[model samples]
Target: MSHIKDVTGGTPIVLESLWKTYANFVAVSGIDLSVGAGRFCTVLGPSGSGKTTTLMMIAGFVAPTRGRILVSGRDIAALPPQKRNLGVVFQNYALFPHLTVFDNVAFPLIMRRVPQAEIAQRVERMLETVELAGLGGRYPRELSGGQQQRVALARALVFEPRVLLMDEPLGALDKKLRSSLQIELKALQRRLDVTVIYVTHDQEEALTMADQIVVMQGGRIEQNGTPEDLYDRPATAFVAGFMGDTNLVRGVVMAADKDGTLRIDHPTGRRIIARASGFQAGDHVAASLRPECLSIESPDGPEEPENAWDGRIAAVTYLGDAIRYHVAVGENRPTLAETLVVKAARRGTEHRRFSEGDAVRVRWSRSDARVLPPTRADARILPPMQAGGH
Candidate 1:
């Protein structure tokens, strides 16, 4: 197992116009990606977005209709699953029910016909690495979900494969356990320096674990970058809304101010000033503002903000550490229908001051808002409100 550590660092993976097509459906489109050696990269997307399919193609479990999968600059698209030397951990654990934990982790070595003595030694080391040294005799059914997941991970990692592929391996665990495992799994990857191509729809998991994130949608890449790059300055409306809680306000560019800010006219006659790129008067756009950017002020406040608006407190949702105020603005719109969400964190002994039906000012800094092109995802008059704290 000491020698295994030296061999397990990683290998660079490249997908050259990779695609998977079945009759009329294209599961994965032409995707070109370069995953660096020893990097933890997560393929993130919703169901049917081709993220899992791309992962399968990389593992050689699914044959690509076109293009090549390369490892260490060598094409492996035609290689069989066993010859690819890529380890996989599925969501189901995929352990042999009849085998003990030691045997499960040793299965790959056995298949490769490594000496029995070597297999036993390596299995013990891997079990200890995964913090399961004393549970080698336990069967799959006898272990708890988290333990079983660790067993599955141990099995995949024990082979010292060049690349590790995991497909929602912690999906079945409870929330708290899943979070715990996410940390442990990331720590393990760092210690081993393994190249990991993980697939998940969980944005938080992707953000927490991956050094790089590739966001997929409709069989094509929507965006790829470090977590902060994607979250702070998303290039599209979908990315803006999907990555976090944001207000999407549709408007037409009325004019560009001398300071490089654009004046946008909303349908409800509200004018918004925000920073944007590549647009002119008469162009329609959507402005994205994070809830935390907005602040609630009393109606009688001396000086209203530049972007302040008069609104009535519609509803208040209590979060453990913060409160979400749904403030209704614009005439003729229902209280909850066209509301602005303002989130305020609570300091010790601080209490909410406004109640429903109270007049208030919902305002945010002009710099806090970002303007993006109108997207199909925001076809609704007002984009759907996602659950907060993404």
Candidate 2:
């Protein structure tokens, strides 16, 4: 395995203003993205968000309407799918029903006209790598779902392609199996140092499996960064709302403080003091607060800094490790859609439990509530990454 790492590994991939359109409909907008060698990058979005289209273009399966695809430093935009030297694992695993696992894994080498003996040797080793060592003779239906997935993986990696593109590869498995495979797949990638461009709509899978997560929407990239960066410091409201559970309250800026803060007038007729910048007194804004960031207590229980909203608990959900409470704004609107959700850790006897109709106050630190910036035009797209990329 160590020798293989020195001899075989990934190549950098660059997409320069990649665009794919059909008449009036644009499947993929002009987008610039750079994926370095051996990094796992996941393109995440809901279906029809163009993630699959972008990946298909990269794999040479679909012709791009415009722009270039570069592997390493060379432009390979015009190459055919088989000539691209990239391995693709489709959502269904796409195993041949009639072929045995051994023959399936050896298909690539056989196509390339490798000697019969070497093909056997490589297929055997790959089967072992994916923990399907003794089941090479089994057919796809004879194996469980997870086993079939491993067979698919073994088949793809047997020939050792430079980059692996997986379009929702684990989407068919159950939750437990999918979680376990995420760890195994990441470990296998680390050992081989293979660059992967994975596409999925599952945000948890994207967060867990990717070194870089690219969030796409409406045929455009909303943001791309490391998982921590995307989670903690998202650049857009779309990213914040899409990444996980959050409370979004619409409001208008009432005042701007000197130290990068804003006073917002909420629809509930209360003011929200948020740590933010770049807004005038009259600008409309929305504040994003995560469910876990808010604390709930009796109105007179404790006084905290920042801002507080007096509300009644509208709903209560008991998770195993934490309790979640949905609190309404006030008596006037007891069941508004903009209700605040608060999650409290249940630490045995030290936690305080509340009922659904109990009076409660929700408060968050000034830094925790972010006044989202105004949505910009497509001006945020990166410049062409290659002049002929260096």
Candidate 3:
């Protein structure tokens, strides 16, 4: 049997071309990844997209149909879950119902036959670390959801395992509670320098907590990078759309200049200049621009010398922090523009200004746009922007 500590000093874990199939159906397909010691890695995807399956395989709950799993440099494909010495925190905060918070945090040490006095000292220190030093005697039923989660976390860390795996551990809490815990958890992980593999379907959670993100779809890795890398420079169309709100425009490449500039001819025959590289003439392409990248203007004046398009305002929405304007440019296509609410309010009264059917111009910087290859069959259009009611 392979040992977990063999790979813990530098390389914490490695999955070599991992594959998991259930009968004839594949759950995880050909995944290769490495988690270095003290790094925070997140596996992000929607449900049944193989993120959970991948986590289970690493934890030894689901045996792989192919490939080997190594903890450090030694192969542990056949090791049992208990033998691997890993800590896991689940979505439900699986603390023993009858045990007090202190006992729950101390259970792992007790199971390994540690002395009672040492367990007490360790448990007390862990409680302080989680800011629950005085709540150790309260049972799971008595503590709030957040408090119980902290106890669960303390339990996982008290064992001093080589790796920590969490499967949507904050999925059950309210938004406010979840956000607070996200910050706490991230700080704790960095302080302890633990190798963490977190699984979640929530994009915000992954972006908030992970040092590196691995996006999965259909049992395969779609993309992997730092949060900024994925957000600012998505390598694929799916990555761009999935990461956040983006405006995608389809056009034919009119020119591929030497300075990574692309001149595209939209379907309406309007030309737009954008930033891109590595494309041939006559190639079909798509450009992704964030809503905040576009600025709006009245159409009556002489046209502003900008990358501007004329469109009719389809709708206006006031989202406390910002105003979202949906501009109808052509048949069945609308571009969204957003501005700070403070700026919109300074312009004029809400009801009298910028109503639907008003002609307007949408302008954006060429540098704010990214040109990419046209999306494949699986690419999905962004959700329509919700207008704030007047």
Q: Which of the two candidates, 1 or 3, achieves a greater TM-score against the reference? A: 1
Error of 2 at 250 (Å): 1.3
Per-residue CA lDDT of candidate 1, range 152-181, in tens?
999998878868999998887889878877
Per-candidate clash tally: 0, 0, 2
lDDT of 2 by residue, 2-44 (tens): 1112224468888887888776677788878988888999998
User: How would you encode candidate 3's per-residue C-alpha lDDT over 192-249 as one tens digit per residue?
Assistant: 6778999887888888898889988778887888999888887776778788777777
The 0-to-1 C-alpha lDDT of every candidate, in the order given, reads 0.82, 0.83, 0.77
Error of 2 at 195 (Å): 0.8
TM-score of each: 0.88, 0.89, 0.83
TM-score of 2: 0.89
Q: After superposition, how far is residue 276 of candidate 1 from its true place, in Å?
A: 1.5
What are the runs in model 3 whose C-alpha is more than 4 Å off?
1-11, 131-135, 138-148, 301-306, 331-353, 374-390
Superposed on all Cα atoms, the candidates' RMSDs to the truth, in angstroms, are: 7.5, 4.6, 8.6
Q: Which stretches of candidate 2 lie above 4 Å from their native place? A: 1-9, 141-146, 301-305, 334-336, 374-390
lDDT order, best first, reads 2, 1, 3
Off by over 4 Å in 1: 1-9, 257-259, 301-305, 335-337, 376-390
